[model samples]
Target: MLQHWLLGSLALQNIGRRKARASLLIAAVAISSAIVFTGVVMMRSIETSMAVGFSRLGADLMVVPQNALTNITAALLTAEPTGEVLDADLLDQAHITGISRAAPQRVFRTEQSEFGGQGESVDLIGYDPGNDFTIQPWINERLGRPMQPGDVILGAARDVPLGSEIALFGKPFRVYAKLGRTGAGTHERGIFMPSAELLALVPAIREQTRKTPPMLEPRKVSGFLIELTPGATELQVRFALLSHLSGTKVVAGGSLLTGIRQGVTALLGGAISLVSMMFASTALMVSVLFSAIVTERRSELGLLKAIGAKRSQIVGMVLIEAIVATGGGGLCGVVFGMLLLRLFERSLVYYLTEIGVPFLWLDRMDTVLVAAACILGAGLIGAIGALTPAWRSSRHDPYDLIRGEG
Candidate 1:
C-alpha cells in the first residue's frame, strides 16, 4: 500500500510530463546549495591544519621574546617573523623550574636556502643539538647520520630536497635530512643548524658572541619551548612559571588555538547563516511555482478523489515530484563544487607558500562532508517547497474543483 501511494503511475507521470517546472526547481537549488557547502569545507580545512600543526610541536608552552608568538606562529605557520629579543638566561631559568623541560635557541631570518637554486627567505634556527626541547630529533635524524656543526636540516616546508648542499653567507653545508610535514607550519619553512655552524658563517657574529649573540642580542633566546613533567597539569605549571618569570610570560597551546578557532567559527557561522537566508528565499520561489501548478490541476485532483483516490495519496504525489527535482540538483552541485576546489588549489599554494604558511590539503573526509551537506540541504528545501502544494491539493472540495461551480 505504501509503495503504491509513493510509486503510483500518476505520481510518476506528473514529473516526467512537466519539463518546465522540474528544470526551474532544480536550477534554483543547485546554485545556492553549492555555495553553502563550499564555504564550510574551506574554513574547516584551514583551521584543522593549524590545530594539527600546533599539536605536532609536542610542547606544552612556547616561550618566545615578549609578544613573539604572533610573529613566531606567523613565521612558522605563515612564514613571516616578528618579535624583539629576551635574555638567553630565560632558557636556563625555565629549566630550573624543576617541573619543565626548556629548549632555547636563536632564530635568524634571512634568504638562506639549501642546494641553492633561488634563495628563499628562511628562519635559520641555531641550537645546541644536545639540548633542543623540540625539533632537534627531526634535525639530528639518525637514518643517514647525526648532524654535525656544519650540517643543516630542511623543514618539510623548505623548498629544497634532502641531501642537498645549502649555503648561507658563502658557507656551504650539507642538508642532513628533511623533517616530517608539520602541516603548513614554521618548521616547514626553517633551516636548523648547530649554534657553532651559524656563528662560523657570519664574521660580525663571531666577535662578542657571548654564549653566542642571538640573531638579535639582549634579545638572546627568542623564547623557550617548555614541556611540563609527567602527571602534572599544564595550567598548574603555567601559573607557577609565570609567577616566577615575572616580566616574561608563558602561554599554553590550548589558549592560543582556542582563540583562533573561535574567531574562525564565528566568521564561518556568520557566512553560512547569510547563505541559508538566501536559500530560504529561493525555496519560497519554488513553493510558489509548485503551488500554482497544483491549483491549475485541481479538477484532476477532484476527479481522482471522486474515483476513490485518498486526499493523502494525492498530496504525496505532489511532494514526491518536488523531491525528485531537488535531489538531482543537489548531486550536481556537490560534484561541481569539488572540481572547483581542485582547480583552485594550485593557485592558492603560491600565495600561501610565499607567505610561509602551511598548505591545507582537501582530502577525502572533506569531500564526504561536503557531499552530505549538499544532499541534506536539498532534502530540507524540497520538503519546504512541497508543503504549500501538498496542503492545497488535499483541502480541495471535489464538487467545486470538478463542476466549475462553487
Candidate 2:
C-alpha cells in the first residue's frame, strides 16, 4: 500500500510538471462527457414524459354504438357523450382478444335542476372508479381520500370549488376533485362520478325530467374505453373488436399523436447514435495522445526501470495519472451538465408546462447514479487508452529507451 501511494504521488507530480498537456487532455474528456451526460438524461426524461402524457390520454381505442355520431378527428383524448347506448356486458360477451382493460362509461345529458344554467345541457359521466383509467388520472387537485358515493369530479371549466356541495338533477353531491384542462369538449365541461352512484341517481333524474331517459336503462353504458395489451397493434385490436361485436365502431385514441410519437422515437435514435460516435472519437483521441505522452517521457521511464522499478509499477504510475485526469474532467462535466439541464428546465420545459404539455426530469438519485457512471466510464476509458503504449514502452530494453531509439 505504501509503495502504491508513493507511485501515485510520483504520477501526480509528473502531471503537474506538464500542466498545459494535462489541462488539454482534461478539457477534451470534459467536453465528451458533458455531451454524453446531457444527451442521455434529456432522452430518458423526454421518453418518460411522453409515456405519462400518452397514458393519461385515456384509452388506445373507444367502442361506441355503431350508429353513434362521432367526429373521428376530434375525439382523441375523451370522446363527447353520445346518446346511443350499448349493453354494459358487451365486451364480456364478445371475449375480445388483445384487450388488457375495458372501462365502461355511462353518460346522462340533462338541462334541469342544477349545475348548469336554465336550458344549458350538462353531461354527467359515470365511471367505475376501480376500472377507470381516463377520468381519475387527470385529477390535478382533490381531497385527501378516495372518491366515494355521492362525491363528484368537475371538469376544468367548472367554477365549483372542491368540497363544496352542488345539486345535480335535484340531488346534492360533494365536489371531490377537479380534472386538469384536457383540451377536449366533453372533458372540459363534464362531471364524473362512480357508475354505482350514477345508477342510484337514475330515479332522481327520472323524477326531475318527468320522463324516461334511454341512456339510464339498466345494464347500459355510453361507451367502452379499451386499453390494449403490449405488442397489440391498434389496427389488429380494431379488427378483432369489429369481428366480435356487430353494432359498435372503434375510435383510435392514439391516431392523432401517432406521428408525434414516431418523431420522438426517431429523435431518440439519433441522439444515441451521436453519443456513441462522440465516445468513439474521444477514445481514439485518448489513445493517440497517450502514445505521444509515452514517447516524450521515454528516457525518464527508462531511468526508473534501470534503477529498480518493475513493469507493473511503471504501468500503475501511468494508469494513475490517466485515471486522475479523466476522472476529474468527468466530475467537472457532470457539474456543467447539471447547469445545462437547469437552463433547459427554465426555458423550454417551463414553456411546455405552461402550455399544458407534461415534462418530467430524472429524479435526484438517478442523476447521481448517471454522474457516477460517467466518472467511472471516463476513468476506465483512460486506462484502456494508456495500456498499450505503457506496456510496449515498459517491454523495451532500458538502454534503447534511454537512448530514445525504440
Candidate 3:
C-alpha cells in the first residue's frame, strides 16, 4: 500500500509539472463519461414522461366505435383526431364488471375558439365531472371552480392567463379556471364544457339534414375511461375488454408508457453514442501523444535505472505520472459535462414536453456514473500510455548509461 501510495504521489507531481498535456487527456475521458451518463438519464426521463402523457387518456379502456383507434391514438399523441360518436351504454356495462370504475367522456370541437388570444378553431372534450377529476388531478381548480358548463380551463396558455372570455361557435365561454401545466395535451390548447352544452352547439341531425347534406351524424358520446381495481392487471383487463367489447381497443396504460420510454431511449442512445465516439477519438489521440512523450523520455528513464531504481519501481513511477495527468483532466471534464447537460435540458424543454417527453435534470446516480467513468477512463489512458515506456526502460542496463559517458 505504501509503495502504491508513493507511486500515486509521484504521478500527481508529474501531471502537475506538465499541466496542459494532463488537462487535454483528462478532457477526453471526462467527455466520454458525461455522454454515457446523459444518455442513460435522458432515456429514463423521456420514458417516464411518455407514460404519464399516455395515462392522460382519462380512460383505461377507450370504447370508441369501430375504426376509431387511430383517432383516439391521435388525440392521445398529438391532440388531433376527428370526432366519433359511440354508444353511451357501454360505460354502464364496463362499470358493472365489478373490476373497476368506468366513466364516459364526449369529445367534439367548436368551429372557432377564443382561446388563441383571438377566435380560432379549437377541439373540445366534455367529461363526467365526478370521474374526470380522478384521472386528471392536474385539472384542479385554479380560479373560479371545477369545470361546469361554459367554464373552460387553459394550459400555461402561453402568455395568456386565465379569466378570459372565449367565444366558441356562437356561444360565449368563460375561462373560469386555469389548469396546471400538463406538458402538452389536446386540452392544452382546447376548451372544456358540459357535454349537454357541446351538443347544444350542433343542431339536431335531422334539422341539419334539411338545410344541407347532414354535415354530421347525430352526435353520441365519444368514449369511455375505465380505472382498474387494485391488483387488476392492465394487460388482462385490456384483452378482456376486447373479448367482450368488439370493435374497440383497450390500450394498456403500461404499454403506452413503455413505448414512449423506448422511443426516447433510442433517440438519446443514438445521439449519446455519437457524442461519446467523439470523446473516444480524443482519448485515442491522448494515448498516442503520451506514448510519444514516453518514448522521448527514454534517456531520462535510463539514467534513473543507472542510479539503481528497480525496474518495477520505475514502471510504477511512470504510471503514477500518467495517472495524475489524466485524472486531473477527467475531473475538469466532469464539471463541464454537468453544465452541458443542464444547458441542453434548458434549450430543449419545450420540444421534449411537446411530445410528452421530458429532459430531466441529471440525478445523483447519473452524476456518480459520469464521475466513475471519467476516473476509470483517465486511469486506463494513463496506464496504457506508460506501458511501452515502462517496458523499454525496464530493459535498460547500467552499462548503457556508463557507455554513454565513455
Candidate 4:
C-alpha cells in the first residue's frame, strides 16, 4: 500500500512537471468529446420532438366518407369543413378490432353566415367532448370549470379572453379556452364545441344561412378520428376499419410519415458513426503522445526499477497519469457542451418555437447519463492508449536505459 501510494504521488508529480504538454492533450480530448456530446444530444432531442408532435396530433388514422373530397394536411391536423356526411352510428355498429378510442367530428364553414367577419371564414368543429383526444391536448389556457353546453373553445389565433361571451349565429356562447399555436390552419383558426351543442344550433344556423350542410343533418358527422390500442400497427387497424365500415376511406398518417422517421433515424446513425471515428482518432493521438513520453523518461524509469519498482508499478504509474488527464478533460468537455447547447436553444430552438414549430429537449436525467458515459469512455481510452508504450518501456534492461543506449 505504501509503495502504491508513493508511485501515485510520483505519477501526479510527473503530470505537474509537464503542465503545457498535459494541457494540450487535455484540450484535444476535450474538444473531441464536446463535439460528440453536443451532436448526440441534439439528434436525440430532434427525434423526441418529432414523437411528441405526432402524439399531440391525436390521431394515427382518419376515416372519411368514400369519395369525399379531402386535404392531406387537414387529415394530419384537424379535418377540414367538408360538407360530406356519414352515419354517426357507424362507429358503434362497426366494432372494429384494435380501436382504443374513436371521436366523431362535424365540420361546417360559416362563410355564408359571416360568423367572424364579412368575407372571413370560421370552421365550426363539433366534437364529442367525452371522447375527444386532439383539441384538449393543445389547450394553453382555459376556465377551471368543466366545459358545458353553450361553451366554445377558440383556436390560438382568436383574440378572445376566457369567460367572455361571443354570439354564434345570433345565440350567445361563453369562451371556454384558447388553444396553443399548432401551425395548422384548422387548429389555429377553428372554433370547437360539443357535438350536442352544435347540433342544437342547427336550427339557428339554418335560419341565418337559408341552407344546412349535409354534415349538419341529424345523426350525421363529417368524419371520425381514431386512436389504436397498444401493440396495434396502423396497417392492422386500417384493414379492420375497411372490413367493417363500408363506403369509408381511411387516411393513415403513419404510412405517410414513415419515410420522415426513417430519414431522421439514418441521420442519427450517421452522427453516431462520425462521433465514434473522432474518438478513435483521439485514442490514436493519445497513444502516440504517451509513446513519446515513455521514450523521453527512459533514464528516470530505469532508476526507479533499479531501486526495486515492479514492472506492474511502472505501467500503473503511466496509466494513472493518462487517466487523470483524460478524465479531467472529459468533465470539462461536458461543461462546455452544456454551454453550447444553451446557446443553441436561445438562438435556433427559441426561433422555431416562436414560429409555432414543435421542439423538445432531452430530459435532464438522460442528458446527465450521456455525459457520464463520455467521461468513462475517455478514461478507458486513456488506459488503452498508454498500455503498450508503458509495457514496452518497462521490459527494457535498467543498465541500457540508464546509459541512453535503448
**Residue range 373-399, candidate 2, lDDT tens digits:** 888888888888898999999998888
lDDT order, best first, reads 2, 4, 1, 3
Candidate 4 matches the true fold with a TM-score of: 0.57
In candidate 2, list every pair of residues with a backbone clash. none
Candidate 3 CA-lDDT value: 0.58
Per-candidate TM-scores read 0.51, 0.66, 0.46, 0.57
Each model's backbone clash number? 14, 0, 7, 0
Best by TM-score: 2
User: Alpha carbon lDDT of residue 399, candidate 4?
Assistant: 79
lDDT of each: 0.63, 0.83, 0.58, 0.83
In candidate 3 the C-alpha lDDT for residue 235 amounts to 69
Q: Tell me which residue pairs clash in candidate 4.
A: none
Clashes of 2: 0
Mark the 10 consecutive residues where model 4 has the least summed lDDT. Answer: 254-263
Residue 406 of model 4, lDDT score? 59
Off by over 4 Å in 3: 27-265, 342-359, 392-406
> How much is the lDDT of residue 158 in candidate 3?
38
